[model samples]
Target: MIQSIQYSLDVIQDEARQLVQKGVVSRQQPIYVLCNYIPAREWGWVESELEKSDFLLRDRIGDLISHENWEND
Candidate 1:
């Protein structure tokens, strides 16, 4: 058997808003700070924070590195 669940836009939006308010999803400033100012020694801590905020830092960094390599080659 297969099951499917559907959510209404208002429900989805409300859930997303709650996540943002709870720090489970982050705003742009935090992401920018992580990108620009995170120290090497604090990478693990920063990565943990990003994970908690539902950011796929490892996968995103991998993609960015690949793109940069491709651009240079």
Candidate 2:
């Protein structure tokens, strides 16, 4: 039982770390950052870029990955 618990915790921690890293990358290089040099009215391009970026997709995929690992743990 203790072995199982420890293995589960270790898996969960590793999965969580992956999620955190993905989140940090999404936030740090977000499309919004590109709007800093553009005019306010040009934010649409930045918004569009952000919408198509892997940020949301990565987050959702990461969630699934983490969930799978946690559930088995």
Candidate 3:
């Protein structure tokens, strides 16, 4: 059986960063798009965390992530 992983704000950010690294998602994309990338079973947890963190579906992925190398030079 697959163990369920909890999706906290930190985990969401980490996963977003990796997605950015993998070019699967860009920081400018809407947060809603993440549902397409994340497994359906876990997306609910992630979405809830985002909502609690004051994030909207239309919010940019960058809003969830912190300052990193992606910053404009």
Candidate 4:
């Protein structure tokens, strides 16, 4: 049986924000760039979550993030 993965918009948004804060990805990149960090097998779940939320793969990370926040290093 195939395992079902659950993804929430808030989770995806928070994840993208974290990735940007950690320098794993930049805000200028497309949302699809996130797939590189997520396992290939799980991208379908993430993609569907994004789609359900009206997010497009071509949407920039900066656009997808609800807000931009930076921590002092």
After superposition, the stretches of candidate 3 with alpha carbons farther than 4 Å from their true spots are 67-73
Candidate 4 wrongly placed segments (more than 4 Å): 1-4, 67-73
Candidate 3 is scored at a TM of: 0.80
Query: Model 1: C-alpha RMSD to truth?
Result: 14.0
Residue-wise C-alpha lDDT for candidate 3, range 12-31, written one tens digit per residue: 88888899889999999988
lDDT, candidate 1, equals: 0.41
Q: Order the candidates by lDDT, highest first — what do you get? A: 4, 3, 1, 2
Clashes of 4: 0
Cα deviation at 22, candidate 2, in Å, is: 26
The candidate 4 region of ten consecutive residues with least summed lDDT is 62-71
Off by over 4 Å in 1: 27-73
> Which 10-residue window of candidate 2 scores lowest in summed lDDT?
1-10
Could you tell me which residue pairs clash in candidate 1? none
Instruction: Please give the lDDT score at residue 48 for candidate 1.
Output: 58
Best by TM-score: 3
Candidate 2 structure quality by residue, lDDT tens digits, 10-56: 34335445544656423333333333444566455434433444234
Model 2 ranges off by over 4 Å: 1-31, 56-73
lDDT of 4 by residue, 1-73 (tens): 9876676777778889999999999999999999988778888889998888778999999988864345899
Clashing residue pairs in candidate 2 (N, C-alpha, C atoms within 3 angstroms)? none
